[model samples]
Target: MRRRRLPATALAVLALVTAGGCASSPPPPPPQTRAGHPERGAQLIAQYGCGSCHTIPGIDRADGLVGPPLTRFGARSYIAGKLPNSDDNLRRWISDPQAVVPGNAMPNLGIDQIDAQDIAAYLYTLD
Candidate 1:
């Protein structure tokens, strides 16, 4: 018994397919802001105990591994690996994690829209 070699054309097609499969999707747009207060957002983060789960920069005792580290969240292109990293998206995610990413480890802290915006504003400053 012996193995048969694939044709040159077959190998070329395979290579193209493999390359396409490995291609990464383009990143989302940069972060946007509207009616947000960074100072309030920072205060809210601590008030809500967000540091207990996320590693927020500039916030003392905000070193946790339960969630992704938010060292440069403002510079990121996406939120939860899907939604664009805009202020609106961040607000929505903060208000209700389940709605943004179902079954996500982040819980819905019952945060209102205003507080969410504040939080997003603070996160944008990390960049």
Candidate 2:
């Protein structure tokens, strides 16, 4: 018996139609909170020089390798691989990393509660 194969272009078209454009979709907006401001948080992240360590998305010149890349921070399950990624926990971790895990790479930036909230807000928008 003889066999025949479909052309590559035809296969590509079939795949695209069957998979619904490969499931590509714009992610939903990050949940909002009254106390935090994402815009302000972006400024704070730059002012605090967080980009020197972590490669944060959206922020300019946020290319760093010391800390983890914050490309999809909103989808993260845990902060510092320890505490839950809730707003409160994230705020605490941002404010004082040493206090959270005792000797973690993220340093104690002396960020106040409000600033931490804002930073968390900005991070959550990355997703």
TM-scores of all predicted structures? 0.78, 0.73
Residue lDDT tens for model 2, 5-32: 9999999999888776422553333346
Best by lDDT: 1
- lDDT score at residue 55, model 2, on the 0-100 scale: 97
- Write the residue-wise lDDT of candidate 1 on 1-127 in tens digits: 9999999999999988777652276566673545689999999999999999999988989998999999988888788887877877888999999998899999988999999999988999988
TM-score: model 1 vs. ground truth: 0.78
Where does model 1 exceed 4 Å of error? 1-25, 31-34
Report the error of model 2 at residue 22, Å.
Answer: 28
lDDT of candidate 1? 0.87
User: What C-alpha lDDT values do all the predictions have?
Assistant: 0.87, 0.85
